[model samples]
Each structure stands twice: as structure tokens, then as C-alpha cells.
Target: MRVFIGYVSLSGNTEKMAVNIKNRMMAVGCEVYMERLDTVEVDTLKDFDLSFIGLYTWDQEELPYEANEFYEELVQADPQGVKVALFGAGDWSQPRPCGAIDIVSNKMKSCGFAVYDRVLKIDQEAPAPDRIRQCEDFADRALSWGSKRKKWRFFIWNRMQNNPKYQRTAYLLRRALDDYPIK
Candidate 1:
């Protein structure tokens, strides 16, 4: 199965997580493709079985603008059966929850994607060796979960507009896709 990992990094922490994910997956003999969220184009997706998104939260639980923007684009692109997992950089010093994984999980669930798991990382400065290994293990698990086929989205529009939480999020997402000015 083919897998792709996408990430957005500001202080390079998220990028490191992506690299570790790629390397670990490669070691396991899986075909992997990875790109930064900034370079990833929304139009040409659907080439893989699983897609992973990495980002950090900025304010509250909202995803970064770049990653969030890509997610919005995915909403209007016609649904596909892809398993997605989220990983992101966080810090032990902060009170904010893992920004990248949390937002990705919520958004993907809202949009009807089969989500496997969420990985959250604290900033590494003078790090413990076990922590690094844990990160690598998380990557391995993510790839394994990504290999599975997601639950099919039949009657996708009905599911999107009828689900309680998704109903509201999808409306706003539709507006974003159509360039409706946010009020």
C-alpha cells in the first residue's frame, strides 16, 4: 500500500517528526511519500491509500492556517476512502494540548475521514532517549494503521450535513471553499 505524509513546521519540530515517520516507515518496507504542507497542493490528491497530516496549534485548538487551509480544500474535492492520522509538535512547557494532532483528528472526523490515531510530541531540547524511541514507535504504529482501508462514505453529503457537529463545521467549510467572506 502507498502512504503519504504531509506536515507543516515552524520551529522545525514538526518537520523532525515527519522525517522520523518517513524513515521508520521506510525501514518497514512501505512505499512512502512525504511533503510539507506548504508545498502540498490540494488539487492532485488521491494517489495514496493513507495520508498523514502534521501541524501545530497556534491559538486554542485551531490548526495552523496552512494545514487548516489544505483540510478545507479536501472537503470540496469529492470524498475518497483514505485513512488519515495526525502528528504534531508540542512542548512540555506549554499548557496548550498537542495542537497538530488534536485539530487534525477533530477536523478529519468532522469531514468524514477514517482516522486511525493521534501522535503528540513535546519539544526536545535536552531529551531523554526513551522519548525519542517512543516517537519512532508512534510512527511505526501510524504507518501500520494507515495501511487499513477506511469505512466507506456512502451518502457522504447526507452524512456531512446531517451529523450534529459536522453539520456546522461543514457549512463553514463550504463557505471557505467558495470564498464566502467570514462574518
Candidate 2:
């Protein structure tokens, strides 16, 4: 059961949570690979059974510049049969958890990853005690779930190649996503 946590942090709040989550998952018996947002490449996820995404929400729930690049590459690869979780650290703006969760959750869902239940919400106040406990429980559940899920055991076959015209477009889009570095 290999799990990875990919995250982008500025003030270090989201990074702190990623570290804590990795510790918690390790305590619960899972091998966790954590990477800062910039260092991880898209191919790193080829074999991970479960992945967690962390971001620093800015101007609402949007990921900051660097994190956006990481996410774009990930979606470009179109991770097949991988379970994914999305989370972030942001202020208590108008909608709680809506900002990061909304954009990421939808995209991941569209990509066919199994979206898990625990949507963690935290702020400088660190959320309420119950919410913290909820997140802890979520970590335990996710780790256990990840440990048992079966790997796809084969390469992903993108059907888009069946049509040359569409394939060319998709190929160009993927290249664009890769070459476009995050500012």
C-alpha cells in the first residue's frame, strides 16, 4: 500500500498539516511518500494507490501559483484507478471548505478517482475540536482503506488515441500543461 501526499505551501501551514497527516498515516500502518509541491513530477504517481492533495488557498479556494502547476500535470496524466483525497488550509471565508474542495473535488471526481469522505477544514484557529477529531478519524480510515485497495497492475490505455485528430489535440494539451511552469 503506497500512498503519497503532494502539497504546496507558502506560510507552512498546509505543509505542517501534510507532515502531521503523514505521521498519522504511518502510525496507522501505511507507507507514505510526501513531496513538496514543486519537486514531484507527474510520473511519480504511476504506482501510488492513494494520493492526497494539499494547497494554500488564495483569493478564495484557488490553489496558489505553484500548486496549480502540480495539479495541472496530475490531471493531464489522468491517474487511472487511483484513490485521491483533496484538502487545503485557508481562512474561514464565506464558504467553509468550499473554495479548495469545490474545484479539486469536482476535477478529481471527473477524472474517475474514488473521492473519499474526509474533507478536512482548518484555519489559523485550527478548526473546532470535533473537526480535528474528524480529520484524525479520516486519516485512520483512509490509511486502512488505502492499504487494502488493489493496484491496477497495468498501464493506463488512453482511448483517445483511437482517433488521430483527437489524439493530436490531447497530446498538445498535455504538452502545454507540462511545459507551462507555475509562476
Query: What tens-digit string does per-residue lDDT give for candidate 1 at 30-102?
Result: 5789988878765444777777777876766567777767876766664467677777776656576675566
Model 2, 1-183: lDDT tens digits are 577998888887777678777877776445789998688876676678788877767775566878676667656775666777766677875565537666777776776667776776567457546445655676777666555423311111133434575788757756786876322
Per-prediction TM-score? 0.69, 0.70
lDDT of 2: 0.68
Model 1 alpha-carbon miss at residue 151, Å: 16
Which stretches of candidate 1 lie above 4 Å from their native place? 42-45, 124-128, 148-183
- TM-score attained by model 2: 0.70
State the number of backbone clashes in model 1. 0
